[model samples]
Target chain A: MAVTAEEILATYEELSEIEAQFDDVETDIIRHQYNLSKDLYVKREKIVSKIEHFWPLVFEQAPMDIDEFIQPSDSQIILGALKSIDVKRFEIDTPVEGGDPRSVSIRFEFNENEYFENKVLEKKFWWRHGKDGFVGYVSEPVDIKWKAGKDLTNGLLSLAKAAWEEEQTASKKEGKEKKELTPKQKELKEKLDAEAATGAESFFCFFGFIGERVSAEENIEALKKEAEDRKKRQAGEKVEDDDEEMKEDEDDEDWEDEEDLDIFPQGDTIAMAIADDLWPNALKYFTQAQESDDLSDDEDDEDEEGDEEEEDGDKPSKKHKACAHGCKH
Target chain B: MAVTAEEILATYEELSEIEAQFDDVETDIIRHQYNLSKDLYVKREKIVSKIEHFWPLVFEQAPMDIDEFIQPSDSQIILGALKSIDVKRFEIDTPVEGGDPRSVSIRFEFNENEYFENKVLEKKFWWRHGKDGFVGYVSEPVDIKWKAGKDLTNGLLSLAKAAWEEEQTASKKEGKEKKELTPKQKELKEKLDAEAATGAESFFCFFGFIGERVSAEENIEALKKEAEDRKKRQAGEKVEDDDEEMKEDEDDEDWEDEEDLDIFPQGDTIAMAIADDLWPNALKYFTQAQESDDLSDDEDDEDEEGDEEEEDGDKPSKKHKACAHGCKH
Candidate 1:
């Protein structure tokens, strides 16, 4: 009963069909759940907003997926002046065809403090089906207007902002034009990179997150047509120029080089954690805040020096201390 | 903006209502997805069953959640005799009210083997909403009548099965009568406990999994009534016998001692990992078998001795080797 390569290939074909069906079922579930939970989430927002310091406390006790990214500086701003947070499936209610109901926008509201001047920051992620048959969130950079010398990312956000502007400009050009960094931009990027190598990033760097470094509209139609042709080929229909397709796949792999330059490489994961877990379960985290406070208090003596340890041991000691202080705000 | 204890309680009340709504939405989504995917899964099963050694390969490449539980001895039985595996939402289509749609029955079809007499071992887990507001799967033991000297559980399953039978008899008796273990049974339990303390238990013990050691019907009505009364109290309606309710809660903590005696303490988690992840994604795992085979080949030299290490290092080495040999079968 030795399975030949042909048999394995056939099995793969059958399984691919099943996988497609599973994907469709998942997509339907996401859309249906989005529509069903929309109003309830709206109501949830209204209720949670009534409680003071709710958003800050939720962030303080957020799961490691998000908590790992928040720097001590980020916590200072969050605990001090953070007002509220909201997450919305921005495309769910839209009538536009091809708009994904799973796409979300996370909005953070803050009070005036010794930080950025903006009262609101909203970051949107588009649920995308990639040409390579991979599906995930794709996002563009959302610029944060930082006050002079108040940049929490230590110039990384500013450098990334400049690069994003260049990308936007390049995207507007006739072809996929690559831009050369200005000398000043290069200097800033080098300094930021060196600094980033030594320390954890400020969570505010999430705003400057331009995931994948790929344009949303770039060759999308061509990619869709390619995918369609490949699906047809798999169904036993004769397809031409598979060698050319192979070459294109090789070209796609070159995107890895570009991805290496992303300032916040895990932006998509962090965003998902916030949108899916932190936001939806905010109330649970908010309630657990008191329990965590008590737990942290027990370790307070050890935690002061514990903050200087490696990332795994650096469990946001200062934030909890600041939170303990802010508990009386 | 200091949050008072009363304010925190108020916040908890508001959030609990939102959580209930979220739960309902989740239930609806689960039911809807189950119905939608039923036919597709049936079609998938037909296609997969036609392939030889599919189940064996899938078991070899399962996720760590499942792979960790499988002993080398268990793998021998699985890879040699396991023909197919099926998982169904058994109660999803039931017309009866209060039948949870999430309840699942996992069936493992086997060919004639030295391990047990049963041709098909099916374990059903009920989706239960506990009195403590925790929702999870609850299951009773499914007896596997093993041949003498061929038992992989090292006599643990036999002891547990006897205990389960006694408990079932006790459950049928009047006034929650407690069953006293026979002298032999007590001696066997102590031997098995000593053996388990020194080494990892076999995956075959899963068949003896009597999760939570509580009857499914026990106190369910009373618990529901208590929950309702608590809700009424939360909504500012006075409920009688508050002191009695507190005493009942205190008494419930006694169940922890009962839970400690479970032979397979992680049975619920293992069952969920299989049903939710391994079974649904069997084809993915089957395809991944060849890839893991290649990866494990690089480590095969060290893995021979690695098998004798602690549980973390004691991954199923012989299983993969057996799979590699069976690849040509």
Candidate 2:
């Protein structure tokens, strides 16, 4: 299920194997690009709020005796420096030439396509460090950068792990035919695995958030409305293409055997049957959802700007709508 | 921030630690319980849907063998299960009876004090494995059984390795701060650990419907609300009691401060300041809002029954309403 912490780590491990596709990375160094899409600003406040609300539960502050490095892993999709890195226990401060140095520099390399493209975050280290017990500057905010491909791999992995946890808790009735993965499922998972191998953001959210969680969100009707238009994903009970082909061949035969002589109308019968066909593929609605989220990723940036903005520095719109169509980063 | 999967895992770990303190041996076992929660179900569906949607992706099958665990660990999570039992594939339907099969049991063991106990779950030969399929109905449904002071060592630890994934993920983020458990959280965690050790269930929802994927008939919001409340499980945060000596010291400071603010207006100012102190204890109001979500949980259930007797589950007046003194559960 990859729901546990181990699976998340494993997912990241998978993402690490596919780092060549998403972001820019060079050798072992992460090019730490502030890849905030234009719309990310709109959701910045909410993202930050959600993160701040939960982060304290994970990282507690301790007095640090040495300088430390803290940054989101390549698999992480952090919004701001606060959420992206942990500076609570770090004695990381430096004297600014003329201003407070809450800034860090980054260099990006995208699969030998682009290498060491440098970027710096300014006024980032603006928090009082309870650990170091000093109000100073972070001369060098540790640069934890990654190639885009790796970012996607890791993000996808983290999402996959999240999905796994969701599944474990769902409580599938035991002995209820633990369904095997179809070839399409295998490929989706394989692609997920590939993304994980490269340390990039995972598209598995389509699986996690959409596949499992959406049913509970009360948006079924709205989502169902999009089902007809959303067919990028597949139907259920399909193990492989051969099975699907065989099933298609037998569909007509099965159709003829079931009350064909003026007893019941074929339209209603077909509708019910289509609904049955849609049950397994119901989650595929998330694929289009992902695309829609992608589209809104760009649209939301404009809206996110309406809510709040990262006061530190404006990042180029790299904000991928977690769910939207026309989503180009 | 326990915002990421790692953070969430750490939170659960901390909760487990808090659950520990009830009874020494009982709580210890809970620390070993397995918690797959949600990922597997979503993945299984996601993979299947992807397979169905993109039947083209499935070029060929693995040549269906009843015994073969094809792609045993395609996403690595399945591999984790295989690794735990020390086999890539093992037959469950071979039908062994009365071996005390362990399913994914999430137990929370408690002492007479009524505080939280331990929670244990794992993957092993649970009672859910029927001869044919789900309807075979060989055993009783999973029950949250707890014996007085029972040692849950083996049961809790059965799937400890799988839970380790969750634990490690949480530890990764939390280790950077507060230095893991403060010996107190660990004490609390044992209560949950004990449940894992002692109690066993028939069938494991092993990563079932942790979250709602999608529902054509039901509202997504309703499903989401269900998932959220069910997941809530009402695990309380561990609170550290003040030392008696420390309490005395605080009393002494109060008296000293009174002496310092001898003037009337100055004393009033001091009193206001004292009242306004939002530092340590004051922060609790804003931190992790202990809002009652039980109300939201039942909102859907009532709607479903349309005023049926199922509303008995929504007994907020009896349990969670605080009885006007804020003593709600």
Candidate 2: tens digits of C-alpha lDDT, residues A187-247: 3465555544554232212112211111212233323422322232122211111223433
**What is the C-alpha lDDT profile of model 1 across B60-105, one tens digit per residue?**
8777767888889899999999998888887886643345677788
Model 1 chain A poorest ten-residue lDDT run: A316-325
* Global local distance difference test of model 1: 0.66
Instruction: Give me candidate 1's TM-score against the actual structure.
Output: 0.79
Candidate 2 ranges with C-alpha deviation above 4 Å = A1-147, A152-184, A191-208, A212-329, B1-329
Clashes of 1: 2
lDDT of 2 at B11: 43
Lowest lDDT 10-residue stretch of candidate 1 chain B: B316-325
lDDT minimum window of 10 residues, candidate 2 chain B: B131-140
TM-score of each: 0.79, 0.16
Q: What DockQ results do all the predictions give, each relative to the true complex?
A: 0.23, 0.01
* C-alpha RMSD of candidate 1: 8.0
The sequence of per-residue lDDT tens digits that candidate 1 reaches over residues A1-329 is: 68787666666555655766776797788889888888888888787777777788888877886888888888999999999887788787664444566678988899998888899999888766544333556777677778988887777777777766765564456243334554444655676669867888778878877654434553365346545755874676643433445346646343224554567867878888887778766755665575456546765655543333222222211111112112210
Model 2 TM-score (2 dp): 0.16
